[model samples]
Target: MNFPTKLKKLREEKKLKQQDVADKLGIARTTYASYEQGKREPDHATLVKIADFFGVSLDFLLRDENEDFQDKIFEDEAKRILKDPKTFLAARDGEITPEILDAALEIITEQLKEGRKKKSD
Candidate 1:
């Protein structure tokens, strides 16, 4: 996908609205919408802001590759969470409590167990 499409997809995946992205970038919602629609390109500074806001590399945002980006994306996400712990927590809307993490781990463990059983079978 192109940059605009990628941008839109990422924003949506993060459960963010266009206005939220515009507010973060200090741009008008219409301008941000234009960017998502591929009508206008963002300047370098705006590009940097977008990259940082999304916790992604500019290269990842601009590229169409499926390999090697996952690690960079994870690193960027970790950095972003470290940079703004409150926002990170807020983004989860209280859904990521310790109990949730524990439950998720339990689910993963069960899945692994099932995978191993299948392999043995």
Candidate 2:
């Protein structure tokens, strides 16, 4: 299914109205409805919000029909990784080996600063 269809399906499966999702994405209900109706498209930032809200990956959200299964796989694996006992212990202890911690931090920083056009000092 395409983005509009998939988006509507996801929202319906979650038992949410367009306004409910719009509130979560911090956009207007009309805008969200347009997205579902395929009359308008969301930008990368909004797309990120939608994917995050639905717990799917960008690749899965934008990819063709063949890759649908990866959505659940990635979503489940991410949740598992976050809630794993080792991850919990690492958070509690404030360490998970210096290298691993640094890598994780870098990934988070990159994601949070995705639209950067220039480097900061």
Candidate 3:
């Protein structure tokens, strides 16, 4: 499943109307509907809010079920680390120290920001 599908499923599972979610998110119902329709992409901050609202990780919301799971997991994990660098920890194979992982996540976060900036430009 893709983002729109996942978002809609999550909302339905929670038994929420679009307006309820929109009110919580401080957005219009039409904007939330567009998101479920795959017509609009929320920014990074909004993505975080949505994930928090649904009690899900960013990776879960953004993951493409048909794609390679591990690859998406790592990417989403990077986003999660950005949100809480002090608490997040993960290792691919070799052991990684917390300080080193924090630094790496910072770099990834910067890259993600730059990528989004480029897209908007």
TM-score of each candidate?
A: 0.59, 0.58, 0.55
Q: Which model scores highest in TM-score?
A: 1
Question: How far is 61's C-alpha from truth in model 3 (Å)?
Answer: 0.7
For candidate 1, write residues 1-121 as lDDT tens digits.
6788888977886789999999989999999999999999999999999986776678888886666543445555554455665775565453343433454455567879999999999
lDDT of 3 at 43: 88
Candidate achieving higher TM-score, 1 or 2: 1
**Stretches of model 1 off by over 4 angstroms after superposition:** 66-72, 75-121
Task: Give Cα-based local distance difference scores for all models.
Answer: 0.74, 0.69, 0.72
For model 3, name the residue pairs that clash.
none
Once all C-alphas are superposed, what RMSD does model 1 give against the true structure?
7.7
Query: Which residue runs does candidate 3 get wrong by more than 4 Å?
Result: 66-121
Off-target runs (Cα >4 Å) in candidate 2 are: 66-121
Model 1 worst lDDT run, 10 consecutive residues: 94-103
Candidates ranked by lDDT = 1, 3, 2
lDDT of 1: 0.74
lDDT score of model 2? 0.69
lDDT of 3 by residue, 70-112 (tens): 3444455455456765445322223334544565577777989
